[model samples]
Target: MRILWTTLLMACAAACTQPANKSVPETIEPDEAHIALAETLTPADPTLAPIYDRSCRACHALDGLGAPLTGHAAAWAPRLEERGMEGLLGSIHAGRGAMPSMGYCADCTDDNFRALIEFMSTEGQS
Candidate 1:
Protein backbone atom coordinates (compact mmCIF):
# COMPACT_ATOMS: atom_id res chain seq x y z
CA MET A 1 0.00 0.00 0.00
CA ARG A 2 2.82 2.44 0.89
CA ILE A 3 4.68 1.67 -2.34
CA LEU A 4 1.55 2.24 -4.43
CA TRP A 5 0.88 5.61 -2.78
CA THR A 6 4.50 6.74 -3.36
CA THR A 7 4.34 5.70 -7.01
CA LEU A 8 1.13 7.64 -7.57
CA LEU A 9 2.58 10.76 -5.97
CA MET A 10 5.74 10.53 -8.06
CA ALA A 11 3.70 10.05 -11.22
CA CYS A 12 1.54 13.04 -10.45
CA ALA A 13 4.57 15.24 -9.78
CA ALA A 14 6.29 14.22 -12.99
CA ALA A 15 3.17 14.78 -15.04
CA CYS A 16 2.56 18.20 -13.49
CA THR A 17 6.16 19.35 -14.11
CA GLN A 18 6.49 18.21 -17.71
CA PRO A 19 7.37 21.03 -20.09
CA ALA A 20 4.62 22.47 -22.24
CA ASN A 21 4.45 21.33 -25.88
CA LYS A 22 7.04 23.13 -27.95
CA SER A 23 4.95 22.77 -31.13
CA VAL A 24 2.46 25.27 -29.76
CA PRO A 25 4.09 28.64 -29.05
CA GLU A 26 3.40 30.22 -25.66
CA THR A 27 2.88 33.57 -27.37
CA ILE A 28 2.52 34.39 -31.04
CA GLU A 29 4.28 37.66 -31.76
CA PRO A 30 2.88 39.98 -34.41
CA ASP A 31 5.08 40.52 -37.43
CA GLU A 32 6.68 43.83 -38.38
CA ALA A 33 4.05 44.52 -41.04
CA HIS A 34 1.28 44.22 -38.49
CA ILE A 35 3.14 46.47 -36.08
CA ALA A 36 3.67 49.07 -38.80
CA LEU A 37 0.00 48.97 -39.72
CA ALA A 38 -1.01 49.22 -36.07
CA GLU A 39 1.14 52.32 -35.72
CA THR A 40 -0.86 54.12 -38.39
CA LEU A 41 -4.32 53.11 -37.19
CA THR A 42 -6.39 55.93 -35.79
CA PRO A 43 -9.96 56.82 -34.99
CA ALA A 44 -11.78 58.12 -38.05
CA ASP A 45 -13.30 61.00 -36.17
CA PRO A 46 -10.97 63.99 -36.28
CA THR A 47 -11.66 64.94 -32.68
CA LEU A 48 -10.76 61.50 -31.43
CA ALA A 49 -7.76 61.07 -33.71
CA PRO A 50 -5.40 63.42 -31.86
CA ILE A 51 -6.44 62.11 -28.51
CA TYR A 52 -5.79 58.57 -29.63
CA ASP A 53 -2.50 59.51 -31.19
CA ARG A 54 -1.33 61.31 -28.10
CA SER A 55 -2.62 59.05 -25.38
CA CYS A 56 -3.72 55.62 -26.59
CA ARG A 57 -1.49 54.82 -29.55
CA ALA A 58 1.81 54.23 -27.78
CA CYS A 59 0.85 51.09 -25.86
CA HIS A 60 -2.29 49.94 -27.67
CA ALA A 61 -0.70 49.83 -31.12
CA LEU A 62 2.30 47.76 -30.10
CA ASP A 63 2.52 44.05 -29.39
CA GLY A 64 3.91 42.26 -26.30
CA LEU A 65 3.25 45.24 -24.06
CA GLY A 66 0.24 43.65 -22.33
CA ALA A 67 -2.07 46.36 -23.70
CA PRO A 68 -4.53 45.02 -26.24
CA LEU A 69 -3.49 45.86 -29.78
CA THR A 70 -5.66 48.51 -31.29
CA GLY A 71 -8.21 47.40 -33.91
CA HIS A 72 -7.84 43.79 -32.89
CA ALA A 73 -11.43 42.69 -32.39
CA ALA A 74 -10.51 39.32 -30.96
CA ALA A 75 -8.30 40.92 -28.34
CA TRP A 76 -10.89 43.46 -27.35
CA ALA A 77 -13.94 41.23 -27.55
CA PRO A 78 -13.54 39.50 -24.19
CA ARG A 79 -12.87 42.80 -22.43
CA LEU A 80 -15.89 44.49 -23.97
CA GLU A 81 -18.10 41.52 -23.29
CA GLU A 82 -16.89 41.02 -19.75
CA ARG A 83 -16.75 44.62 -18.61
CA GLY A 84 -19.14 46.38 -20.98
CA MET A 85 -18.48 50.02 -21.90
CA GLU A 86 -18.95 51.50 -18.47
CA GLY A 87 -16.59 49.10 -16.76
CA LEU A 88 -13.99 49.66 -19.43
CA LEU A 89 -14.31 53.38 -18.93
CA GLY A 90 -13.87 52.83 -15.24
CA SER A 91 -10.65 50.96 -15.92
CA ILE A 92 -9.42 53.87 -18.00
CA HIS A 93 -10.39 56.31 -15.30
CA ALA A 94 -8.62 54.35 -12.58
CA GLY A 95 -5.98 52.92 -14.89
CA ARG A 96 -5.59 49.19 -15.48
CA GLY A 97 -2.40 47.26 -15.92
CA ALA A 98 0.14 49.46 -17.69
CA MET A 99 -2.42 52.06 -18.74
CA PRO A 100 -2.20 55.36 -16.90
CA SER A 101 -5.16 57.00 -15.24
CA MET A 102 -7.73 58.33 -17.69
CA GLY A 103 -5.55 56.59 -20.27
CA TYR A 104 -3.38 59.70 -20.10
CA CYS A 105 -6.16 61.81 -21.61
CA ALA A 106 -6.65 64.33 -18.87
CA ASP A 107 -9.26 66.42 -20.62
CA CYS A 108 -11.26 63.64 -22.20
CA THR A 109 -14.86 63.22 -21.19
CA ASP A 110 -16.84 60.01 -20.88
CA ASP A 111 -18.11 60.52 -24.42
CA ASN A 112 -14.57 60.80 -25.71
CA PHE A 113 -13.54 57.61 -23.93
CA ARG A 114 -16.62 55.88 -25.35
CA ALA A 115 -15.73 56.84 -28.92
CA LEU A 116 -12.08 55.90 -28.43
CA ILE A 117 -13.03 52.53 -26.99
CA GLU A 118 -15.37 51.91 -29.90
CA PHE A 119 -12.64 52.72 -32.39
CA MET A 120 -9.95 50.64 -30.71
CA SER A 121 -12.22 47.65 -30.17
CA THR A 122 -13.42 47.55 -33.78
CA GLU A 123 -11.66 45.72 -36.58
CA GLY A 124 -10.67 46.97 -40.08
CA GLN A 125 -10.14 50.54 -38.92
CA SER A 126 -7.72 52.61 -40.94
Candidate 2:
Protein backbone atom coordinates (compact mmCIF):
# COMPACT_ATOMS: atom_id res chain seq x y z
CA MET A 1 0.00 0.00 0.00
CA ARG A 2 1.16 3.62 -0.64
CA ILE A 3 0.66 4.57 3.01
CA LEU A 4 2.76 1.65 4.18
CA TRP A 5 5.61 2.58 1.81
CA THR A 6 5.43 6.24 2.91
CA THR A 7 5.61 5.25 6.56
CA LEU A 8 8.61 3.04 5.95
CA LEU A 9 10.38 5.81 4.00
CA MET A 10 9.63 8.34 6.74
CA ALA A 11 10.97 6.04 9.41
CA CYS A 12 14.13 5.38 7.43
CA ALA A 13 14.71 9.08 6.87
CA ALA A 14 14.24 9.90 10.53
CA ALA A 15 16.62 7.14 11.55
CA CYS A 16 19.30 8.36 9.11
CA THR A 17 19.26 11.95 10.34
CA GLN A 18 21.90 12.80 12.95
CA PRO A 19 20.98 14.89 15.97
CA ALA A 20 22.00 18.54 15.82
CA ASN A 21 23.65 18.41 19.21
CA LYS A 22 25.75 15.34 19.87
CA SER A 23 26.61 14.52 23.45
CA VAL A 24 30.34 14.88 24.00
CA PRO A 25 32.42 13.42 26.78
CA GLU A 26 33.54 15.71 29.58
CA THR A 27 36.93 17.27 28.90
CA ILE A 28 39.49 18.19 31.53
CA GLU A 29 40.76 21.73 31.90
CA PRO A 30 44.47 21.88 31.23
CA ASP A 31 46.69 24.07 33.37
CA GLU A 32 49.25 26.42 31.89
CA ALA A 33 52.04 23.99 32.75
CA HIS A 34 50.29 21.16 30.95
CA ILE A 35 49.65 23.31 27.90
CA ALA A 36 53.26 24.46 27.82
CA LEU A 37 54.56 20.93 28.19
CA ALA A 38 52.21 19.58 25.52
CA GLU A 39 53.18 22.32 23.10
CA THR A 40 56.84 21.57 23.48
CA LEU A 41 56.62 17.81 23.24
CA THR A 42 57.23 16.00 19.94
CA PRO A 43 58.01 12.48 18.84
CA ALA A 44 61.74 11.75 19.04
CA ASP A 45 61.70 10.17 15.61
CA PRO A 46 62.41 12.68 12.84
CA THR A 47 59.93 11.04 10.46
CA LEU A 48 57.19 10.81 13.03
CA ALA A 49 57.59 14.37 14.33
CA PRO A 50 56.26 15.91 11.13
CA ILE A 51 53.38 13.45 11.02
CA TYR A 52 52.47 14.21 14.63
CA ASP A 53 52.74 17.97 14.14
CA ARG A 54 50.41 17.85 11.16
CA SER A 55 47.91 15.29 12.34
CA CYS A 56 47.78 14.66 16.10
CA ARG A 57 49.20 17.78 17.79
CA ALA A 58 46.25 20.11 17.35
CA CYS A 59 43.85 18.06 19.47
CA HIS A 60 46.08 15.78 21.56
CA ALA A 61 48.30 18.55 22.92
CA LEU A 62 45.43 20.69 24.24
CA ASP A 63 42.73 19.93 26.75
CA GLY A 64 39.01 20.81 26.69
CA LEU A 65 38.87 19.09 23.28
CA GLY A 66 37.89 15.72 24.73
CA ALA A 67 41.33 14.41 23.83
CA PRO A 68 44.05 13.40 26.24
CA LEU A 69 46.86 15.91 26.51
CA THR A 70 50.38 14.97 25.46
CA GLY A 71 52.66 13.86 28.31
CA HIS A 72 49.66 13.32 30.59
CA ALA A 73 50.16 9.71 31.48
CA ALA A 74 47.16 9.61 33.78
CA ALA A 75 44.77 10.71 31.08
CA TRP A 76 46.16 8.30 28.49
CA ALA A 77 46.69 5.47 30.97
CA PRO A 78 43.09 4.30 31.10
CA ARG A 79 42.73 4.45 27.33
CA LEU A 80 45.94 2.54 26.79
CA GLU A 81 44.97 -0.05 29.39
CA GLU A 82 41.46 -0.53 28.09
CA ARG A 83 42.42 -0.52 24.42
CA GLY A 84 45.75 -2.01 23.66
CA MET A 85 47.89 -0.82 20.74
CA GLU A 86 45.77 -2.65 18.18
CA GLY A 87 42.53 -1.35 19.63
CA LEU A 88 43.90 2.14 19.81
CA LEU A 89 44.93 1.89 16.19
CA GLY A 90 41.41 0.78 15.36
CA SER A 91 40.08 3.91 17.09
CA ILE A 92 42.40 6.06 15.01
CA HIS A 93 41.35 4.32 11.83
CA ALA A 94 37.67 4.53 12.67
CA GLY A 95 37.88 8.04 14.13
CA ARG A 96 36.61 8.32 17.69
CA GLY A 97 34.48 11.33 18.66
CA ALA A 98 35.95 14.53 17.24
CA MET A 99 39.02 12.86 15.78
CA PRO A 100 38.92 12.29 12.02
CA SER A 101 39.66 8.96 10.35
CA MET A 102 43.30 7.90 10.17
CA GLY A 103 43.77 10.73 12.69
CA TYR A 104 43.97 13.07 9.67
CA CYS A 105 47.09 11.34 8.49
CA ALA A 106 46.08 9.51 5.35
CA ASP A 107 49.63 8.43 4.57
CA CYS A 108 50.44 7.00 7.97
CA THR A 109 51.19 3.28 8.16
CA ASP A 110 50.52 1.02 11.15
CA ASP A 111 54.06 1.43 12.38
CA ASN A 112 53.71 5.21 12.22
CA PHE A 113 50.53 5.08 14.28
CA ARG A 114 52.19 2.82 16.86
CA ALA A 115 55.12 5.20 17.23
CA LEU A 116 52.84 8.19 17.56
CA ILE A 117 50.74 6.43 20.18
CA GLU A 118 53.80 5.52 22.17
CA PHE A 119 55.05 9.11 22.06
CA MET A 120 51.72 10.58 23.14
CA SER A 121 51.02 8.05 25.88
CA THR A 122 54.44 8.20 27.51
CA GLU A 123 54.81 10.70 30.38
CA GLY A 124 58.40 11.87 30.15
CA GLN A 125 59.00 12.97 26.59
CA SER A 126 60.76 16.17 25.67
Candidate 3:
Protein backbone atom coordinates (compact mmCIF):
# COMPACT_ATOMS: atom_id res chain seq x y z
CA MET A 1 0.00 0.00 0.00
CA ARG A 2 2.83 2.43 0.90
CA ILE A 3 4.61 1.60 -2.35
CA LEU A 4 1.41 2.22 -4.30
CA TRP A 5 0.85 5.54 -2.49
CA THR A 6 4.41 6.68 -3.17
CA THR A 7 4.13 5.80 -6.86
CA LEU A 8 0.81 7.60 -7.11
CA LEU A 9 2.25 10.68 -5.39
CA MET A 10 5.23 10.73 -7.72
CA ALA A 11 2.97 10.47 -10.74
CA CYS A 12 0.81 13.29 -9.42
CA ALA A 13 3.88 15.45 -8.83
CA ALA A 14 5.13 14.79 -12.33
CA ALA A 15 1.79 15.77 -13.83
CA CYS A 16 1.68 18.91 -11.71
CA THR A 17 5.14 19.96 -12.89
CA GLN A 18 3.89 20.99 -16.30
CA PRO A 19 5.07 24.30 -17.69
CA ALA A 20 3.09 27.45 -17.04
CA ASN A 21 0.33 28.26 -19.52
CA LYS A 22 1.46 31.03 -21.85
CA SER A 23 -1.67 31.64 -23.89
CA VAL A 24 -3.85 33.52 -21.40
CA PRO A 25 -4.58 37.07 -22.53
CA GLU A 26 -3.79 40.07 -20.37
CA THR A 27 -6.53 41.35 -18.09
CA ILE A 28 -8.75 44.11 -19.36
CA GLU A 29 -7.86 47.43 -17.78
CA PRO A 30 -10.23 49.03 -15.31
CA ASP A 31 -12.30 51.90 -16.70
CA GLU A 32 -12.21 55.43 -15.30
CA ALA A 33 -15.31 54.81 -13.18
CA HIS A 34 -13.88 51.59 -11.77
CA ILE A 35 -10.60 53.28 -11.04
CA ALA A 36 -12.44 56.09 -9.28
CA LEU A 37 -14.36 53.57 -7.24
CA ALA A 38 -11.22 51.67 -6.25
CA GLU A 39 -9.63 54.90 -5.13
CA THR A 40 -12.65 56.04 -3.16
CA LEU A 41 -14.15 52.95 -1.54
CA THR A 42 -15.09 53.80 2.06
CA PRO A 43 -14.67 51.03 4.62
CA ALA A 44 -16.59 50.43 7.87
CA ASP A 45 -13.81 49.86 10.41
CA PRO A 46 -14.53 52.20 13.31
CA THR A 47 -11.19 51.32 14.91
CA LEU A 48 -9.28 52.61 11.91
CA ALA A 49 -8.45 55.96 13.43
CA PRO A 50 -7.22 54.48 16.70
CA ILE A 51 -5.37 51.81 14.80
CA TYR A 52 -3.64 54.41 12.69
CA ASP A 53 -2.84 56.50 15.71
CA ARG A 54 -1.38 53.59 17.65
CA SER A 55 0.38 51.66 14.91
CA CYS A 56 0.84 53.96 11.91
CA ARG A 57 1.09 57.55 13.08
CA ALA A 58 4.72 57.31 14.09
CA CYS A 59 6.38 57.00 10.70
CA HIS A 60 3.51 58.09 8.46
CA ALA A 61 2.90 61.24 10.56
CA LEU A 62 -0.48 62.77 11.22
CA ASP A 63 0.26 65.77 8.99
CA GLY A 64 1.50 63.79 5.99
CA LEU A 65 5.19 64.44 6.48
CA GLY A 66 7.19 61.48 7.76
CA ALA A 67 5.71 58.72 5.68
CA PRO A 68 2.95 60.86 4.21
CA LEU A 69 -0.44 60.15 5.79
CA THR A 70 -2.79 58.10 3.67
CA GLY A 71 -5.31 60.94 3.69
CA HIS A 72 -3.11 63.35 1.77
CA ALA A 73 -4.66 63.68 -1.68
CA ALA A 74 -1.77 65.50 -3.33
CA ALA A 75 1.03 63.20 -2.23
CA TRP A 76 -0.82 60.14 -3.42
CA ALA A 77 -2.22 61.75 -6.61
CA PRO A 78 1.00 61.48 -8.59
CA ARG A 79 1.51 57.89 -7.39
CA LEU A 80 -2.03 56.92 -8.34
CA GLU A 81 -1.62 58.61 -11.72
CA GLU A 82 1.59 56.69 -12.32
CA ARG A 83 0.91 53.31 -10.69
CA GLY A 84 -2.87 52.86 -10.16
CA MET A 85 -4.60 51.57 -6.98
CA GLU A 86 -3.36 47.98 -7.20
CA GLY A 87 0.17 49.15 -7.70
CA LEU A 88 0.02 51.32 -4.61
CA LEU A 89 -1.49 48.49 -2.53
CA GLY A 90 1.16 46.08 -3.77
CA SER A 91 3.80 48.46 -2.54
CA ILE A 92 2.15 48.47 0.87
CA HIS A 93 1.66 44.72 0.93
CA ALA A 94 5.18 43.92 -0.25
CA GLY A 95 6.93 47.01 1.00
CA ARG A 96 8.16 49.68 -1.38
CA GLY A 97 11.76 50.87 -1.65
CA ALA A 98 11.28 52.63 1.69
CA MET A 99 7.88 51.74 3.17
CA PRO A 100 7.71 48.52 5.14
CA SER A 101 5.26 45.69 4.55
CA MET A 102 1.67 46.31 5.61
CA GLY A 103 2.99 49.71 6.50
CA TYR A 104 3.70 48.10 9.86
CA CYS A 105 0.04 47.69 10.77
CA ALA A 106 -0.06 44.04 11.77
CA ASP A 107 -3.76 44.07 12.64
CA CYS A 108 -4.87 45.51 9.33
CA THR A 109 -7.14 43.46 7.09
CA ASP A 110 -7.60 43.83 3.33
CA ASP A 111 -10.47 46.20 4.07
CA ASN A 112 -8.25 48.14 6.43
CA PHE A 113 -5.62 48.33 3.78
CA ARG A 114 -8.07 49.65 1.19
CA ALA A 115 -9.58 52.08 3.65
CA LEU A 116 -6.20 53.41 4.69
CA ILE A 117 -5.16 54.07 1.12
CA GLU A 118 -8.51 55.63 0.20
CA PHE A 119 -8.67 57.80 3.29
CA MET A 120 -5.12 58.99 2.88
CA SER A 121 -5.52 59.70 -0.80
CA THR A 122 -8.29 62.10 0.08
CA GLU A 123 -6.24 63.98 2.67
CA GLY A 124 -6.27 67.36 1.02
CA GLN A 125 -9.55 66.94 -0.81
CA SER A 126 -11.53 68.44 2.05
Candidate with the greatest TM-score versus the true structure: 2
Q: Give the worst 10-residue stretch by lDDT in candidate 3.
A: 21-30
lDDT of 2 by residue, 49-76 (tens): 9999999999998767888888865556
Ranking by TM-score: 2, 1, 3
Worst lDDT run of 10 residues, candidate 1, spans: 19-28
lDDT of 1 at 67: 81
> In model 2, what is the error at residue 49, expressed in angstroms?
0.6
Which portions of model 3 miss their true places by more than 4 Å?
1-45, 62-66, 124-126
Clashes of each: 0, 0, 3
Q: What is the lDDT of residue 66 in candidate 1?
A: 81
Per-residue lDDT of 1-126 in model 3, one digit per residue for the tens?
544643553454346444332321212222333344433433345667676666665655433233544444444544554566777788888987556888888768877777777766664331
**TM-score of model 1 vs. true structure:** 0.72
Q: Write the per-residue lDDT of candidate 1 for residues 5-122, one digit (tens) a residue.
A: 4355345434644333333222234455556767779887999999999999989898889887776655565565456789899999999988889988999999999999888877
66 Cα displacement, candidate 2 (Å): 0.8
Error of 2 at 43 (Å): 1.2
Tell me each candidate's RMSD, in Å, in order: 13.1, 14.9, 16.6
lDDT of 2 at 87: 87
lDDT (0 to 1) per candidate: 0.73, 0.75, 0.54
